[model samples]
Target: MDAQQFLEEFGHIANAPGGVGKLRELILSLAFKGELCVPSNEISATLLDDIERQRLEFNGETRKQRLTRQSNTTTNLVGPYEIPKHWSWVSLSTVGHTWGQKKPEDSFVYIDVSSIDNKAGVLRQSPEVISASAAPSRARKVVKKGTLVYSTVRPYLLNIAIIDRDFDLEPIASTAFAIVHPWEGISGRYLYFYLRSPIFVRYVESVQIGMAYPAISDEKFYSGVVPLPPTEEQSRIVAKVDELMALCDKLEAQQQARRKLQNALRQSTLQAVASATSPHELQTTWACLADNFGRLFHEPEDVDDLVAELKNLAVRGLLSEASTTSPDLEAIKIDCAQMRARYIADGLIRRQKLVGMADCEETYPAHWAVTAFDEVAIVIGGVTKGRDLRGKQVMVCPYLSVANVQRGHFKLEGLKSIEIAADELAKYQVHEGDLLITEGGDWDKVGRTALWRGGVTNCLHQNHVFKARVPSKQLLNEWVELVFNSGVGRDYFAGASKQTTNLASINMTQLRSFALPIPPLIEQQRILSVLSELTKHCNEWCRQMERKQAMSTLLAGAVVSSLTGITIEQEEEPMKAPQTELVAPLRLGTTPDIKAQAPLATILARHHGEMSAKDLWQRFGGEIDAFYTQLKTEVAHGWILEPAPAEMREKLADSVSA
Candidate 1:
């Protein structure tokens, strides 16, 4: 598409997923490919001659000196795409000279890598002036007006900018940058846009060397290819790019404002509904929502919020028109007592005193009775691992771990096998109508439970999971699961769990003591029926949202491909290595006598012998490779056990597949 047509269609494109950012990238790609503006052979020939004459003058200089000089010869460097005959492919060093490193002599304005806003292609703020004596070792490169500073360290960050105006003091840049001084015939802004192109980014990614601190070497960066357009066309491309980028900025700001307004409207409407004290007020608020639903709930997350509100209203008996009748509280109490006595007499459970209802803060409908979880269900713990099952004849059975249980659902992707004695299967085996709950993990994951429908035979659960079985005809498992998965249940579990740093757990005692709101059987059936229908609709809406998001992304890709003639294929993001249990003993590899070592040495020393490499990484923030490198250093010094290579590979593969 032409520039005017692209601009005209931008309003529609900007509403697509990630349209603004993609549009910026597309502009750069087209500009560098000589597709944004028509190339002029007459103008390019004149500029090429002038650049070649300058290159010849510096041919006599030494290799060290030549590193900063332009080259006269065209080395036949091939770019990702074919350019016009008038435009030529040349090394970056052929059109500009890199400024040599110099120490700060006096007080100077210091431009660190962090000072540049790569996305805007400008300095984030004014550079700080620092004295020569106080200057950091990395502050060594000097720059002047028309110079482009491109950070070589972490090139993926695209920290590049061109100096447009003179500074009060001579500007000194971080050594991490390669300072490019464009020749008299070249447009500095044009070159800056070229460096930000996706092709250059891909090239940088291919040549970057380190894991945690990936960077392109100065020699490789200078040798990198760039498309050289005619001097007159370069100015046209730069001006066009500036205009489009400004338009993108405006579009981004407008989108931000629109989202803020939508959020405010959504929050206000939800609050009005939640605060309504009477049925009439609620009906009015709900009606208002229905009228404006198309505008208020534009995203999937908004629909999710609506679904949650619907559930809350249903449980609170606000959804139905029929008013609640007073429940037989005394009769419920008598039935609970009788059920407890029968269980104790049959030796099915131990009789324990129950806590009073005063402990609960929640209020139920008039027709609902408050009861303890233990009064209606039998809560049981799962089998413990690492016991002596190896010594005896055992059956290998699939077992559920904490990972297998998610809120209102089961994730049976990685069911593990455990050896249990054949006779012990009945005690550990899971059955239909059972509610599986997680015992511990992250703080919010303490009580995630889902109903089991006997999907797999001969399955058991680990100690970190708990199974609650409701006696036949007492209460529906689905209703109990719904109650526990609701906000109230989540709050209770969060408050009741034993919390450590970033972790929480709940025991059988706490689970059994949980107070539940129990409505009459008939009322419960009605609530469940309404909830099921609403939940199904919500899930279908979520699926539609996913499809819409996918279509938007595809449309964005199509726009870029059509404009730049380059197909954009999405690549899967690399996953972190999986965490594993450390079975081998660990110790310090370095001697305590050593005065200095790695920065993580102090932290590693504090860890007891039982801690694993993954635990150390969690405690200290660093890339996985760096952690492994430090770990290897300690292992070399006999401070810790070397990890098994086979295990590491297996875990890495698993993570990649997942």
Candidate 2:
């Protein structure tokens, strides 16, 4: 699509996922190319000549140099793209100069690349003051007011900012920055935005060398092409960019507010479904959620949450109707006992006193039975390494570690091999349908469970991954897996695991005691079937969200490509929300006293009083929109006390200053 076409259809895709950010890029590209607004009535041919005169005059040099463009040939130009016929292309070297290297003679504000927050194109924190004696070797570049300091190291990070204010001490930037003191015609604000442009960013990504500390060289950096306009046009472009950027910022905020409202609505709807007791109640609540599906599920993460909630419902026996009679615990135990005998006879597992036990109260369906995990399955710890068995016969085989076992499925790639005594291989060898549960890792990942369908022959498991062999006749592997990875199973592990710092672990005994809710054999199949169908729909929902995002990105990219006369391709990478760890991951926090309280209130109550926004976000199981909205309702009702306003301001200020 051409620029005109894009503008005409802007309303169709300007609010898609990551669309506002894309729009900001389009604005920058358009501004640089002089396509954002009408050209000035008058044009100056000596704009470049005047800028050159100012450079030599500022440097106190009589010598003049010719401008050399860094032609990546991005738009078949002498520069990266075709600019307005009146505007000229110039080298970054011709545009500016930097203060020569110097050793500090006194205390100075050390403005390192870390001081800048690339997002805002400003210093994120107060540059620290360093005494002359303590100054680092790299603290040699001088940055006065109006100078643009662009970090040479890791240029893709876009650690480029203008020195807009003076400091208490003389600000000495780290040598990592290529300080650009622009000539008379260049606007520092305009230059700052130029360096932050998507076009510039893509150029940096292509030219930066090295893997660990990828950076652009001074020689290459100086040769970078700048799309220059008349001095009058520069001011015009900057003004327009500022105006559009402010709109983007406003749009971004509105999008956030909209998402929060959607989240609030979705969360409340899902909660209704989860809390429904009777089948009729479940049906009504589920229908309500289904009715608002369009509003509730916008992103892949939203659908993921739906899937997770479905599993939670499945495990709790709330997904389907239960039989009028309670499940026969004795009959299930009898069947398991018969299976256990065969397991013992084969010398695969040892006899245990208890079938299994639940850590929490049993509030399951009347037709469901509960028992300890070990009753129906052979729960055994895997092989431990570093034993002095040199004399003993051993064989090398692929083994599953905690990393290899993810919830629901095994990640078999990069399977590390371990040497085990040939005799002990059978004990550690995981069979088809055996459940592999991680013993410990990051606290949240400590009890991750995945079913092992044999991929590698004679595969064994590491000590940190426990293997459970559940007989097919006694319990289906799928049913057990569903429960173990559900909210109930996760809660039990989080509460029972021994924790230290961010690490957590559950011992073999704890794994054996895990409570597995058992429905009638026929009901198990029925529930799984229903869950499978629901999950398929949720997956389709996510796919549709992804498809929509992909199309939006392409449309945005087409607009940018056409407007700038540059080929800009949009990569459709799956969005991944970070997994958050909480101090109170599995605790049944205190119940909220406020009747107006909902998700956020309940989470804060669970954590005793207050929790970090990050922690609360994960627990709330909703988007930022819902969480903040619910939190506001609680705080507004005087049910929650927030941090002092002054403290918040200081924290925010310090963050920006850093």
Candidate 3:
């Protein structure tokens, strides 16, 4: 399609999921290919001559050095694509030379790589003025007005900008950049646009070395090819690109405003539904939502919010009719007491000192009785870590850690193993119909519980997890798990858990004392049955939303490919196979294989000290589950150390020195 046709169809593309970004890429691709503007009769001979004259007059020695450096990398030069007949394919160095580095004589404005806003193609923050002695070593390249600055490292980030005017103090940039001083022939804005093009980015990606800190060398960057249009044509192309980009900005703003309005409407509608005082009012509000569902719930997150509100309403007894039979509280209390006494008499559990329920602010149906969790089930703490088993014979068994436990579900992937003594196995082993709850992690994860249906054989849990087993059949494990995963349960856990920084934990005492609203067996089963059907519908709707989002993405890709004559199939190259190591593959639930642990151990040992989990992932570039599996195994064997807090690290250092 022609430029005008493309511009006209831009709205359609921009409205698709992730379409705006793809539209921007298409604009850049078209502009660089000389398809955005009509070809001119003007020749580039005069422009080239003028550029050479200006370069020679500015700094002859610098020009000579650039040429010498370019000569060495001549063999590495590769043309990205053929240019238009009216345009000339020339090296970037011919029209611009990188500015030389200079140490600051006094305090100067330091514009590091982080200072540039890649998306807006401008400086987001003011440069900092530091003393010459305090200046960072990387802050050595000097930028002047009209100079095009492009970061050499991680060129895919597209941290490229043109210095429009001079600063109050001399502006210095990080050595991570190659400061391009365009000669008379090149339009600085045009060069900046080209630098940000997908072709240039792909070229940089191909040549960039190192996975963690990919960068293009100065020689490679300077010697890269540029499609040079006539000087006047270059100006026209820059202006056209700017105008198109501004249109894209407006389109993006319109989309954002629409989304904001939708979100506001959604929140208000949901609030109305939640605040309904009667079933009739709720039905009316829900009917309104259903009528406008297509317009209101366009995004997957919108569906998620709706599902959450549904769950909240379900637990509040608003979703269905309350059972007519009144619960026999005295009979339930007697039965619970007798069950506890029988378990204690059989030596299956220890006799516990009970704590009275604190005054709770929440109210439930009259048919439901408010009681502590211990009244409904027995809460047991999981096996302790680092316990001495010197004389006790032990067997390796698969166990559930905090990672394995999620809200309402168990992640059976990468289930690790632990050594459990033969006699202590029964105490730690998880049984069917048990409710597994996590003790700590981030605050949101503190009270996450899931039902255990014997998915894994002989599965045990770590100390950070707690197990709640219902002694009587009156309460279902699914019902209890639903209660804990609901908003009411989340609020209780958030308020009751001991919070330190971002992490929170709940001890056995807190778990046992948790207040549970118990309904009669018949009512519980009725509520659960309705919840099961509604939840299934919600999940199916969410899956439909997911499929719609995927289709939108595919449609966007197809549009871009069709316009650029670049097939979508060609864009997606197969991912490189993961690097092989001498270590054997890890087998879940098996005894730790020394060979399997060797690669991870070797990697961690090479590092001086503890590293963040993010940094560790960058080094391996493997699947997240694989990385965590290795990490868990190493931690189990004490081959790698966990990260310590600042105070602890300082104390350890001082003790080591002494």
* Candidate lDDT (C-alpha), each: 0.75, 0.76, 0.75
Top candidate by TM-score: 2
- Number of the top candidate by lDDT? 2
Question: Each candidate's root-mean-square deviation in Å?
Answer: 18.5, 18.8, 16.7
Point out the higher-scoring one by TM-score: 1 or 2. Answer: 2
Compose the digit string of candidate 1's lDDT tens values, residues 506-609.
88878888887777666767778888897898788777676566556655665666567665544323334445432333445554332233334444566644
Q: What TM-score would candidate 1 get against the native?
A: 0.67
Worst 10 residues of 3 by lDDT: 643-652
lDDT comparison, 2 vs 3, better candidate: 2
The residue ranges of model 1 lying beyond 4 angstroms of the native Cα positions read: 1-8, 33-42, 45-86, 96-189, 199-224, 230-240, 276-281, 321-358, 388-397, 417-424, 497-507, 560-658
- Between 2 and 3, whose TM-score is larger? 2
Report the lDDT tens digits of candidate 3 across residue range 1-658. Answer: 5557666766567877878888888888889878888888887666876876886687644755566445733422446565676677677777786667798989998888888889888876676788899999898887888888889988888888888767889989888888788887689999998898777877787788889988898878876778888988999999999998998888889999999999999998988887776668879999998898888888767877787777677667777777787666666667667877876786656888986664567777877788888776777778876778899998888989999899888998888888878787777889998889999899778899999988688889888999888766676677788888888788888888898989998888888888887777787787788777877887787777775665466556556755665433222223233332222222222223332323345444446444455455445444545666766666667665543321111123545658
Error of 3 at 162 (Å): 3.0
Q: Candidate 3's C-alpha lDDT?
A: 0.75
For candidate 2, write residues 148-256 as lDDT tens digits.
9999898878898998898878999998998788888778888888988987888788888999989987767777778877888889889999999999999889889
